[model samples]
Target: MSSVSIHPTAIVASGARLGANVRIGPYCIVGENVVLDADVELISHVVVEGHTHVGAGTRIYPFASVGHQPQDLKYKGEASRLEIGERCVIREAATLNPGTAAGGMLTKVGNECLIMASAHVAHDTIIGNNVIMANYVGIAGHCRIGDNVTFGGTVVVHQRTRIGAHAFIGAQSMVDGDVIPYGMAVGNRASLAGLNLVGLKRRQFDREAIHRLRAAYRMIFSNEGTLRERTEDAAELFKDDDLVQDVVAFITSASDRPILVPRNGQVASED
Candidate 1:
Protein backbone atom coordinates (compact mmCIF):
# COMPACT_ATOMS: atom_id res chain seq x y z
CA MET A 1 0.00 0.00 0.00
CA SER A 2 1.24 3.49 -0.79
CA SER A 3 2.22 5.62 2.22
CA VAL A 4 0.71 8.69 0.56
CA SER A 5 -2.55 9.74 2.19
CA ILE A 6 -4.59 11.25 -0.59
CA HIS A 7 -8.06 12.30 0.43
CA PRO A 8 -10.91 10.81 -1.54
CA THR A 9 -12.11 14.22 -2.62
CA ALA A 10 -8.81 15.08 -4.29
CA ILE A 11 -8.21 14.30 -7.95
CA VAL A 12 -4.70 13.10 -8.73
CA ALA A 13 -4.03 11.73 -12.20
CA SER A 14 -2.62 8.23 -12.52
CA GLY A 15 0.68 9.25 -14.09
CA ALA A 16 1.59 11.79 -11.38
CA ARG A 17 4.35 10.82 -8.94
CA LEU A 18 3.92 11.29 -5.20
CA GLY A 19 6.87 10.43 -3.03
CA ALA A 20 6.88 8.98 0.48
CA ASN A 21 4.64 10.41 3.16
CA VAL A 22 2.91 12.93 0.90
CA ARG A 23 -0.64 14.07 1.71
CA ILE A 24 -3.24 15.55 -0.60
CA GLY A 25 -6.25 17.17 0.99
CA PRO A 26 -9.81 17.65 -0.29
CA TYR A 27 -10.52 18.85 -3.82
CA CYS A 28 -6.84 19.27 -4.74
CA ILE A 29 -5.72 18.25 -8.23
CA VAL A 30 -2.32 16.99 -9.32
CA GLY A 31 -1.90 16.67 -13.04
CA GLU A 32 0.02 14.15 -15.08
CA ASN A 33 3.40 15.86 -15.15
CA VAL A 34 3.48 17.00 -11.51
CA VAL A 35 5.97 15.49 -9.07
CA LEU A 36 5.58 15.80 -5.32
CA ASP A 37 8.67 14.89 -3.34
CA ALA A 38 8.92 13.29 0.10
CA ASP A 39 6.86 14.56 3.01
CA VAL A 40 5.06 17.20 0.96
CA GLU A 41 1.55 18.33 1.89
CA LEU A 42 -1.06 19.89 -0.35
CA ILE A 43 -4.07 21.31 1.42
CA SER A 44 -7.55 21.80 -0.04
CA HIS A 45 -8.24 23.14 -3.53
CA VAL A 46 -4.63 23.22 -4.75
CA VAL A 47 -3.62 22.48 -8.34
CA VAL A 48 -0.12 21.36 -9.38
CA GLU A 49 0.60 20.54 -13.00
CA GLY A 50 2.55 21.14 -16.19
CA HIS A 51 6.11 19.98 -15.58
CA THR A 52 5.95 21.24 -12.00
CA HIS A 53 8.24 19.81 -9.30
CA VAL A 54 7.55 20.44 -5.62
CA GLY A 55 10.61 19.68 -3.51
CA ALA A 56 10.88 17.93 -0.13
CA GLY A 57 8.91 18.95 2.95
CA THR A 58 7.04 21.78 1.27
CA ARG A 59 3.47 22.66 2.35
CA ILE A 60 1.16 24.15 -0.25
CA TYR A 61 -2.05 25.65 1.08
CA PRO A 62 -5.58 25.95 -0.29
CA PHE A 63 -6.63 27.51 -3.63
CA ALA A 64 -3.12 28.13 -4.93
CA SER A 65 -3.07 27.83 -8.73
CA VAL A 66 0.58 26.86 -8.87
CA GLY A 67 2.29 25.65 -12.01
CA HIS A 68 -0.37 27.26 -14.12
CA GLN A 69 0.03 28.97 -17.49
CA PRO A 70 2.21 32.06 -17.67
CA GLN A 71 0.20 35.27 -17.87
CA ASP A 72 2.37 36.80 -20.58
CA LEU A 73 0.68 37.63 -23.86
CA LYS A 74 3.59 36.17 -25.79
CA TYR A 75 3.26 32.61 -24.43
CA LYS A 76 2.80 30.08 -27.21
CA GLY A 77 1.82 26.92 -25.30
CA GLU A 78 5.36 25.75 -24.75
CA ALA A 79 6.31 23.05 -22.24
CA SER A 80 8.20 25.26 -19.83
CA ARG A 81 8.51 24.43 -16.12
CA LEU A 82 7.93 25.67 -12.58
CA GLU A 83 10.35 24.57 -9.83
CA ILE A 84 9.59 25.25 -6.16
CA GLY A 85 12.51 24.50 -3.87
CA GLU A 86 12.76 22.63 -0.59
CA ARG A 87 10.87 23.28 2.64
CA CYS A 88 9.02 26.29 1.32
CA VAL A 89 5.58 27.27 2.64
CA ILE A 90 3.19 28.53 -0.03
CA ARG A 91 0.25 30.12 1.69
CA GLU A 92 -3.37 30.42 0.61
CA ALA A 93 -4.42 31.60 -2.83
CA ALA A 94 -0.91 32.34 -4.13
CA THR A 95 -0.37 31.81 -7.85
CA LEU A 96 2.89 30.68 -9.45
CA ASN A 97 3.05 30.67 -13.22
CA PRO A 98 5.20 28.72 -15.62
CA GLY A 99 7.80 30.31 -17.91
CA THR A 100 7.06 31.57 -21.41
CA ALA A 101 9.22 31.23 -24.50
CA ALA A 102 10.25 34.85 -24.33
CA GLY A 103 10.80 34.78 -20.57
CA GLY A 104 12.99 31.70 -20.15
CA MET A 105 12.49 27.93 -19.77
CA LEU A 106 11.52 27.90 -16.11
CA THR A 107 10.26 29.89 -13.13
CA LYS A 108 11.80 28.94 -9.80
CA VAL A 109 11.04 29.60 -6.15
CA GLY A 110 14.10 29.12 -3.98
CA ASN A 111 14.34 27.27 -0.66
CA GLU A 112 12.60 28.41 2.51
CA CYS A 113 10.77 31.42 1.10
CA LEU A 114 7.32 32.15 2.55
CA ILE A 115 4.98 33.34 -0.18
CA MET A 116 1.95 34.70 1.63
CA ALA A 117 -1.69 34.51 0.57
CA SER A 118 -2.80 36.14 -2.70
CA ALA A 119 0.76 36.89 -3.82
CA HIS A 120 1.44 36.22 -7.50
CA VAL A 121 4.84 35.44 -9.02
CA ALA A 122 4.67 35.80 -12.78
CA HIS A 123 6.41 33.90 -15.53
CA ASP A 124 10.19 33.44 -15.34
CA THR A 125 10.59 35.35 -12.09
CA ILE A 126 13.32 33.69 -10.02
CA ILE A 127 12.81 34.08 -6.27
CA GLY A 128 15.78 33.44 -3.99
CA ASN A 129 16.12 31.71 -0.64
CA ASN A 130 14.64 32.75 2.71
CA VAL A 131 12.54 35.60 1.34
CA ILE A 132 9.26 36.71 2.96
CA MET A 133 6.51 38.19 0.81
CA ALA A 134 3.52 39.59 2.59
CA ASN A 135 -0.09 39.24 1.42
CA TYR A 136 -1.22 40.37 -2.03
CA VAL A 137 2.27 41.06 -3.41
CA GLY A 138 2.60 40.84 -7.19
CA ILE A 139 5.94 40.20 -8.93
CA ALA A 140 5.85 40.59 -12.70
CA GLY A 141 7.65 38.67 -15.44
CA HIS A 142 11.41 38.01 -15.33
CA CYS A 143 12.08 39.75 -12.00
CA ARG A 144 14.95 38.38 -9.91
CA ILE A 145 14.35 38.58 -6.16
CA GLY A 146 17.32 37.97 -3.88
CA ASP A 147 17.68 36.10 -0.60
CA ASN A 148 16.47 37.12 2.87
CA VAL A 149 14.28 39.89 1.52
CA THR A 150 10.93 40.96 3.04
CA PHE A 151 8.15 42.63 1.05
CA GLY A 152 5.17 44.22 2.74
CA GLY A 153 1.59 43.65 1.62
CA THR A 154 0.46 44.59 -1.90
CA VAL A 155 3.99 45.24 -3.19
CA VAL A 156 4.00 45.49 -6.98
CA VAL A 157 7.33 44.78 -8.62
CA HIS A 158 7.46 45.79 -12.27
CA GLN A 159 8.76 43.49 -14.96
CA ARG A 160 12.51 42.80 -15.18
CA THR A 161 13.33 44.56 -11.91
CA ARG A 162 15.76 42.93 -9.48
CA ILE A 163 15.26 43.18 -5.74
CA GLY A 164 18.42 42.42 -3.82
CA ALA A 165 19.10 40.49 -0.62
CA HIS A 166 17.99 41.72 2.81
CA ALA A 167 15.89 44.45 1.25
CA PHE A 168 12.66 45.66 2.90
CA ILE A 169 9.87 47.14 0.80
CA GLY A 170 7.04 48.79 2.65
CA ALA A 171 3.36 47.96 2.04
CA GLN A 172 1.46 49.13 -1.07
CA SER A 173 4.82 49.98 -2.59
CA MET A 174 5.31 50.08 -6.34
CA VAL A 175 8.76 48.88 -7.31
CA ASP A 176 9.49 50.29 -10.77
CA GLY A 177 13.26 49.79 -10.52
CA ASP A 178 15.90 47.48 -9.14
CA VAL A 179 16.29 47.50 -5.37
CA ILE A 180 19.83 47.29 -4.00
CA PRO A 181 21.00 44.96 -1.25
CA TYR A 182 20.20 46.04 2.30
CA GLY A 183 17.77 48.66 1.04
CA MET A 184 14.51 49.81 2.63
CA ALA A 185 12.38 51.22 -0.17
CA VAL A 186 8.85 52.56 0.20
CA GLY A 187 6.05 54.46 -1.59
CA ASN A 188 4.92 54.66 -5.20
CA ARG A 189 7.87 54.13 -7.53
CA ALA A 190 9.56 52.78 -4.37
CA SER A 191 12.42 55.06 -3.44
CA LEU A 192 15.00 53.91 -0.92
CA ALA A 193 14.07 54.96 2.60
CA GLY A 194 17.22 53.75 4.27
CA LEU A 195 19.27 50.66 4.98
CA ASN A 196 17.15 47.67 5.99
CA LEU A 197 18.07 47.79 9.69
CA VAL A 198 15.38 45.53 11.09
CA GLY A 199 16.11 42.96 8.43
CA LEU A 200 19.84 42.99 9.27
CA LYS A 201 18.99 42.52 12.97
CA ARG A 202 16.87 39.52 12.11
CA ARG A 203 19.79 38.07 10.16
CA GLN A 204 22.00 38.70 13.21
CA PHE A 205 24.41 41.01 11.43
CA ASP A 206 27.07 42.49 13.69
CA ARG A 207 27.21 46.17 14.57
CA GLU A 208 30.23 46.80 12.36
CA ALA A 209 28.62 45.34 9.26
CA ILE A 210 25.44 47.23 9.91
CA HIS A 211 27.43 50.45 10.31
CA ARG A 212 29.27 49.82 7.10
CA LEU A 213 25.98 49.30 5.31
CA ARG A 214 24.65 52.54 6.79
CA ALA A 215 27.69 54.46 5.58
CA ALA A 216 27.19 53.03 2.11
CA TYR A 217 23.53 54.06 2.22
CA ARG A 218 24.64 57.56 3.21
CA MET A 219 26.89 57.81 0.19
CA ILE A 220 24.14 56.55 -2.05
CA PHE A 221 21.27 58.55 -0.63
CA SER A 222 22.13 61.37 1.78
CA ASN A 223 25.20 62.76 0.05
CA GLU A 224 23.11 63.58 -3.03
CA GLY A 225 25.86 62.15 -5.16
CA THR A 226 25.17 61.19 -8.76
CA LEU A 227 24.91 57.49 -9.56
CA ARG A 228 28.42 57.35 -11.04
CA GLU A 229 30.16 59.32 -8.25
CA ARG A 230 28.36 57.48 -5.47
CA THR A 231 29.18 54.15 -7.04
CA GLU A 232 32.88 55.00 -7.33
CA ASP A 233 32.95 56.17 -3.71
CA ALA A 234 31.06 53.08 -2.56
CA ALA A 235 33.48 50.85 -4.43
CA GLU A 236 36.43 52.40 -2.58
CA LEU A 237 34.71 52.14 0.83
CA PHE A 238 33.18 48.66 0.44
CA LYS A 239 35.91 46.73 -1.37
CA ASP A 240 36.05 44.21 1.46
CA ASP A 241 32.35 43.29 1.88
CA ASP A 242 30.62 41.57 -0.98
CA LEU A 243 27.21 42.67 0.30
CA VAL A 244 28.15 46.29 -0.16
CA GLN A 245 29.48 45.39 -3.56
CA ASP A 246 25.97 44.12 -4.36
CA VAL A 247 24.67 47.63 -3.74
CA VAL A 248 27.16 49.10 -6.17
CA ALA A 249 26.64 46.41 -8.77
CA PHE A 250 22.86 46.72 -8.79
CA ILE A 251 23.10 50.45 -9.31
CA THR A 252 25.71 50.26 -12.07
CA SER A 253 24.07 47.40 -13.94
CA ALA A 254 20.80 49.32 -14.20
CA SER A 255 20.01 50.54 -17.70
CA ASP A 256 18.19 53.70 -18.85
CA ARG A 257 15.45 52.78 -16.39
CA PRO A 258 17.59 53.51 -13.36
CA ILE A 259 16.65 51.75 -10.16
CA LEU A 260 14.50 53.56 -7.59
CA VAL A 261 16.28 56.49 -5.92
CA PRO A 262 16.01 57.27 -2.19
CA ARG A 263 13.45 59.78 -0.93
CA ASN A 264 14.38 62.02 1.99
CA GLY A 265 11.23 62.93 3.93
CA GLN A 266 8.34 60.99 2.49
CA VAL A 267 6.11 59.25 5.03
CA ALA A 268 4.38 55.93 4.31
CA SER A 269 0.89 54.99 5.45
CA GLU A 270 -0.77 51.66 6.26
CA ASP A 271 -4.06 52.09 4.46
Candidate 2:
Protein backbone atom coordinates (compact mmCIF):
# COMPACT_ATOMS: atom_id res chain seq x y z
CA MET A 1 0.00 0.00 0.00
CA SER A 2 2.80 2.39 0.79
CA SER A 3 5.48 1.43 -1.77
CA VAL A 4 3.96 2.92 -4.96
CA SER A 5 2.75 6.33 -6.07
CA ILE A 6 -0.85 7.56 -6.07
CA HIS A 7 -1.88 10.71 -7.91
CA PRO A 8 -3.62 13.65 -6.28
CA THR A 9 -6.84 13.46 -8.27
CA ALA A 10 -7.64 9.90 -7.20
CA ILE A 11 -10.40 9.37 -4.63
CA VAL A 12 -10.01 6.21 -2.55
CA ALA A 13 -12.80 5.29 -0.20
CA SER A 14 -12.17 4.43 3.44
CA GLY A 15 -13.80 1.03 3.07
CA ALA A 16 -11.66 0.11 0.04
CA ARG A 17 -8.75 -2.23 0.62
CA LEU A 18 -5.45 -1.73 -1.21
CA GLY A 19 -2.66 -4.24 -0.84
CA ALA A 20 1.10 -3.77 -0.86
CA ASN A 21 2.79 -2.62 -4.09
CA VAL A 22 -0.48 -1.30 -5.49
CA ARG A 23 -0.33 1.92 -7.53
CA ILE A 24 -3.25 4.19 -8.31
CA GLY A 25 -2.69 6.88 -10.90
CA PRO A 26 -4.42 10.15 -11.78
CA TYR A 27 -8.20 10.67 -11.74
CA CYS A 28 -8.77 7.10 -10.49
CA ILE A 29 -11.83 6.47 -8.33
CA VAL A 30 -11.93 3.48 -5.94
CA GLY A 31 -15.26 2.93 -4.24
CA GLU A 32 -15.89 1.95 -0.64
CA ASN A 33 -16.60 -1.73 -1.17
CA VAL A 34 -13.77 -2.30 -3.62
CA VAL A 35 -10.90 -4.56 -2.54
CA LEU A 36 -7.64 -4.73 -4.51
CA ASP A 37 -5.13 -7.43 -3.74
CA ALA A 38 -1.34 -7.19 -3.67
CA ASP A 39 0.78 -6.00 -6.61
CA VAL A 40 -2.23 -4.75 -8.54
CA GLU A 41 -1.63 -1.58 -10.55
CA LEU A 42 -4.25 0.86 -11.76
CA ILE A 43 -3.39 3.32 -14.49
CA SER A 44 -4.95 6.76 -14.88
CA HIS A 45 -8.69 7.41 -14.95
CA VAL A 46 -9.84 3.96 -13.83
CA VAL A 47 -13.09 3.62 -11.88
CA VAL A 48 -13.66 0.57 -9.67
CA GLU A 49 -16.90 0.46 -7.70
CA GLY A 50 -19.91 -1.54 -6.51
CA HIS A 51 -18.48 -4.23 -4.25
CA THR A 52 -15.77 -5.33 -6.65
CA HIS A 53 -12.92 -7.59 -5.52
CA VAL A 54 -9.78 -7.73 -7.65
CA GLY A 55 -7.29 -10.54 -7.08
CA ALA A 56 -3.54 -10.32 -6.59
CA GLY A 57 -1.14 -9.25 -9.38
CA THR A 58 -3.92 -7.97 -11.64
CA ARG A 59 -3.33 -4.74 -13.53
CA ILE A 60 -5.97 -2.37 -14.84
CA TYR A 61 -5.04 0.13 -17.52
CA PRO A 62 -6.37 3.61 -18.21
CA PHE A 63 -10.10 4.40 -18.53
CA ALA A 64 -11.25 0.94 -17.41
CA SER A 65 -14.55 0.73 -15.51
CA VAL A 66 -15.15 -2.34 -13.34
CA GLY A 67 -17.95 -3.44 -11.02
CA HIS A 68 -20.45 -0.87 -12.17
CA GLN A 69 -24.16 -1.58 -11.78
CA PRO A 70 -25.59 -4.30 -14.01
CA GLN A 71 -27.12 -3.52 -17.40
CA ASP A 72 -30.12 -5.74 -16.79
CA LEU A 73 -33.43 -3.93 -17.10
CA LYS A 74 -34.94 -5.98 -14.29
CA TYR A 75 -32.28 -4.77 -11.89
CA LYS A 76 -33.52 -2.72 -8.94
CA GLY A 77 -30.34 -2.16 -6.97
CA GLU A 78 -30.19 -5.49 -5.23
CA ALA A 79 -27.08 -6.49 -3.30
CA SER A 80 -24.76 -7.95 -5.94
CA ARG A 81 -21.00 -8.50 -6.26
CA LEU A 82 -18.13 -8.81 -8.78
CA GLU A 83 -15.03 -10.96 -8.34
CA ILE A 84 -11.90 -11.02 -10.52
CA GLY A 85 -9.25 -13.70 -10.04
CA GLU A 86 -5.47 -13.49 -9.79
CA ARG A 87 -3.02 -12.20 -12.43
CA CYS A 88 -5.60 -10.78 -14.82
CA VAL A 89 -4.75 -7.87 -17.15
CA ILE A 90 -7.60 -5.57 -18.09
CA ARG A 91 -6.57 -3.30 -20.93
CA GLU A 92 -7.62 0.31 -21.47
CA ALA A 93 -11.29 1.22 -21.77
CA ALA A 94 -12.47 -2.29 -20.85
CA THR A 95 -15.75 -2.29 -18.94
CA LEU A 96 -16.89 -5.11 -16.60
CA ASN A 97 -20.19 -4.84 -14.81
CA PRO A 98 -21.46 -6.60 -11.70
CA GLY A 99 -24.22 -9.20 -11.66
CA THR A 100 -27.88 -8.62 -10.99
CA ALA A 101 -29.67 -10.31 -8.09
CA ALA A 102 -31.86 -12.31 -10.43
CA GLY A 103 -28.79 -13.68 -12.23
CA GLY A 104 -27.09 -14.61 -8.98
CA MET A 105 -25.57 -11.90 -6.81
CA LEU A 106 -22.04 -12.38 -8.08
CA THR A 107 -20.20 -12.35 -11.41
CA LYS A 108 -16.85 -14.12 -11.49
CA VAL A 109 -13.76 -13.81 -13.71
CA GLY A 110 -11.11 -16.47 -13.39
CA ASN A 111 -7.31 -16.22 -13.20
CA GLU A 112 -4.85 -15.18 -15.91
CA CYS A 113 -7.42 -13.58 -18.17
CA LEU A 114 -6.62 -10.83 -20.68
CA ILE A 115 -9.48 -8.52 -21.55
CA MET A 116 -8.42 -6.17 -24.31
CA ALA A 117 -9.36 -2.54 -24.89
CA SER A 118 -13.03 -1.64 -25.38
CA ALA A 119 -14.16 -5.12 -24.30
CA HIS A 120 -17.28 -5.36 -22.18
CA VAL A 121 -18.33 -8.14 -19.80
CA ALA A 122 -21.91 -7.49 -18.91
CA HIS A 123 -24.04 -8.57 -15.95
CA ASP A 124 -23.91 -12.14 -14.60
CA THR A 125 -21.40 -13.42 -17.16
CA ILE A 126 -18.89 -15.99 -15.91
CA ILE A 127 -15.50 -15.91 -17.68
CA GLY A 128 -13.02 -18.67 -16.98
CA ASN A 129 -9.25 -18.82 -16.54
CA ASN A 130 -6.68 -18.22 -19.30
CA VAL A 131 -9.29 -16.66 -21.53
CA ILE A 132 -8.56 -13.91 -24.07
CA MET A 133 -11.09 -11.36 -25.20
CA ALA A 134 -9.77 -9.25 -28.00
CA ASN A 135 -10.49 -5.58 -28.62
CA TYR A 136 -14.13 -4.49 -28.79
CA VAL A 137 -15.52 -7.88 -27.72
CA GLY A 138 -18.91 -7.67 -26.05
CA ILE A 139 -20.40 -10.44 -23.86
CA ALA A 140 -23.98 -9.99 -22.80
CA GLY A 141 -25.78 -10.89 -19.57
CA HIS A 142 -25.84 -14.41 -18.07
CA CYS A 143 -23.32 -15.77 -20.57
CA ARG A 144 -20.84 -18.45 -19.53
CA ILE A 145 -17.43 -18.52 -21.24
CA GLY A 146 -15.22 -21.44 -20.36
CA ASP A 147 -11.49 -21.83 -19.68
CA ASN A 148 -8.72 -21.41 -22.28
CA VAL A 149 -11.11 -19.73 -24.71
CA THR A 150 -10.07 -17.07 -27.24
CA PHE A 151 -12.49 -14.49 -28.58
CA GLY A 152 -11.55 -12.56 -31.68
CA GLY A 153 -12.05 -8.82 -31.93
CA THR A 154 -15.64 -7.51 -31.96
CA VAL A 155 -17.18 -10.93 -31.25
CA VAL A 156 -20.61 -10.49 -29.67
CA VAL A 157 -22.36 -12.99 -27.39
CA HIS A 158 -26.04 -12.87 -26.73
CA GLN A 159 -27.66 -13.22 -23.33
CA ARG A 160 -27.68 -16.68 -21.68
CA THR A 161 -25.32 -18.06 -24.30
CA ARG A 162 -22.84 -20.70 -23.17
CA ILE A 163 -19.48 -21.27 -24.83
CA GLY A 164 -17.64 -24.36 -23.71
CA ALA A 165 -14.00 -24.64 -22.67
CA HIS A 166 -11.15 -24.39 -25.18
CA ALA A 167 -13.27 -22.92 -27.96
CA PHE A 168 -12.15 -20.22 -30.39
CA ILE A 169 -14.69 -17.63 -31.50
CA GLY A 170 -13.82 -15.67 -34.63
CA ALA A 171 -13.91 -11.89 -35.05
CA GLN A 172 -17.18 -10.00 -35.51
CA SER A 173 -19.14 -13.20 -34.92
CA MET A 174 -22.59 -12.90 -33.40
CA VAL A 175 -23.10 -15.91 -31.12
CA ASP A 176 -26.68 -16.48 -30.09
CA GLY A 177 -26.56 -20.07 -28.76
CA ASP A 178 -24.23 -22.59 -27.18
CA VAL A 179 -20.79 -23.38 -28.56
CA ILE A 180 -19.49 -26.82 -27.69
CA PRO A 181 -16.01 -27.61 -26.40
CA TYR A 182 -12.90 -27.95 -28.60
CA GLY A 183 -14.61 -26.25 -31.54
CA MET A 184 -13.70 -23.39 -33.85
CA ALA A 185 -16.76 -21.18 -34.29
CA VAL A 186 -17.46 -18.28 -36.68
CA GLY A 187 -20.19 -16.47 -38.67
CA ASN A 188 -22.71 -13.65 -38.29
CA ARG A 189 -25.30 -15.92 -36.67
CA ALA A 190 -22.38 -17.99 -35.47
CA SER A 191 -21.91 -21.66 -36.38
CA LEU A 192 -19.31 -24.27 -35.62
CA ALA A 193 -16.89 -24.30 -38.53
CA GLY A 194 -14.58 -27.07 -37.32
CA LEU A 195 -12.35 -28.26 -34.51
CA ASN A 196 -10.04 -25.63 -33.03
CA LEU A 197 -6.76 -27.06 -34.19
CA VAL A 198 -4.63 -24.16 -33.03
CA GLY A 199 -6.15 -24.26 -29.59
CA LEU A 200 -5.82 -28.03 -29.40
CA LYS A 201 -2.19 -27.90 -30.42
CA ARG A 202 -1.44 -25.07 -28.04
CA ARG A 203 -3.11 -26.93 -25.22
CA GLN A 204 -1.45 -30.13 -26.45
CA PHE A 205 -4.59 -32.14 -26.91
CA ASP A 206 -3.58 -35.76 -27.56
CA ARG A 207 -3.96 -37.37 -30.98
CA GLU A 208 -6.71 -39.68 -29.74
CA ALA A 209 -8.65 -36.73 -28.32
CA ILE A 210 -8.41 -34.62 -31.47
CA HIS A 211 -9.36 -37.53 -33.67
CA ARG A 212 -12.40 -38.36 -31.58
CA LEU A 213 -13.56 -34.75 -31.50
CA ARG A 214 -13.28 -34.54 -35.27
CA ALA A 215 -15.38 -37.64 -35.71
CA ALA A 216 -18.03 -36.36 -33.33
CA TYR A 217 -18.23 -33.03 -35.18
CA ARG A 218 -18.70 -34.86 -38.46
CA MET A 219 -21.60 -36.90 -37.19
CA ILE A 220 -23.49 -33.94 -35.75
CA PHE A 221 -23.23 -31.47 -38.61
CA SER A 222 -22.42 -33.52 -41.71
CA ASN A 223 -23.96 -36.97 -41.33
CA GLU A 224 -26.32 -37.95 -44.13
CA GLY A 225 -29.04 -38.90 -41.65
CA THR A 226 -31.38 -36.73 -39.61
CA LEU A 227 -30.36 -35.53 -36.16
CA ARG A 228 -32.71 -38.09 -34.60
CA GLU A 229 -31.16 -40.71 -36.82
CA ARG A 230 -27.61 -39.80 -35.86
CA THR A 231 -27.63 -40.92 -32.26
CA GLU A 232 -24.81 -40.59 -29.75
CA ASP A 233 -23.96 -44.24 -30.25
CA ALA A 234 -23.23 -43.51 -33.93
CA ALA A 235 -20.32 -41.32 -32.82
CA GLU A 236 -19.25 -43.81 -30.14
CA LEU A 237 -16.14 -44.84 -32.03
CA PHE A 238 -14.36 -41.94 -30.33
CA LYS A 239 -16.13 -42.31 -27.03
CA ASP A 240 -12.86 -43.12 -25.30
CA ASP A 241 -11.80 -39.52 -25.82
CA ASP A 242 -13.22 -37.17 -23.21
CA LEU A 243 -13.11 -34.23 -25.57
CA VAL A 244 -15.31 -36.10 -28.02
CA GLN A 245 -17.65 -36.95 -25.18
CA ASP A 246 -17.87 -33.24 -24.53
CA VAL A 247 -18.99 -32.65 -28.08
CA VAL A 248 -21.57 -35.41 -27.89
CA ALA A 249 -23.05 -34.03 -24.68
CA PHE A 250 -23.29 -30.54 -26.17
CA ILE A 251 -25.24 -31.68 -29.23
CA THR A 252 -27.55 -34.05 -27.35
CA SER A 253 -28.07 -31.44 -24.65
CA ALA A 254 -29.02 -28.64 -26.99
CA SER A 255 -32.73 -28.24 -26.33
CA ASP A 256 -32.83 -24.66 -27.61
CA ARG A 257 -30.91 -23.92 -30.82
CA PRO A 258 -29.86 -26.78 -33.08
CA ILE A 259 -26.18 -27.60 -33.13
CA LEU A 260 -24.58 -25.64 -35.98
CA VAL A 261 -24.54 -27.10 -39.50
CA PRO A 262 -22.39 -26.32 -42.54
CA ARG A 263 -23.85 -25.01 -45.78
CA ASN A 264 -21.79 -27.55 -47.73
CA GLY A 265 -23.42 -30.34 -45.67
CA GLN A 266 -20.02 -31.47 -44.43
CA VAL A 267 -18.50 -31.33 -40.93
CA ALA A 268 -14.84 -30.59 -41.69
CA SER A 269 -13.81 -27.30 -43.33
CA GLU A 270 -11.55 -26.85 -46.39
CA ASP A 271 -8.95 -25.09 -44.37
Tell me the whole-model lDDT of each prediction, alpha carbons only.
Answer: 0.87, 0.85
165, model 2: CA deviation in Å? 0.9
Give the Å error, residue 71, model 2: 1.4
What candidate 1 gets wrong by more than 4 Å, as runs, is: 222-225, 254-257, 264-271
| Error at 222, model 1, angstroms | 4.2
Query: What TM-score should be assigned to candidate 2?
Result: 0.93
lDDT per residue for candidate 1 within 5-76, as digits (tens), equals: 999999999989999999999999999999999999998999998889999999999999999888887888
Candidate 2 on 82-173: residue-level lDDT in tens? 99999999999999999887888878999999999999999998999999999999999888889999999999998888888999999999
Model 2 lowest lDDT segment of ten = 254-263
TM per candidate comes to 0.93, 0.93
Runs off by more than 4 Å, candidate 2: 228-231, 254-258
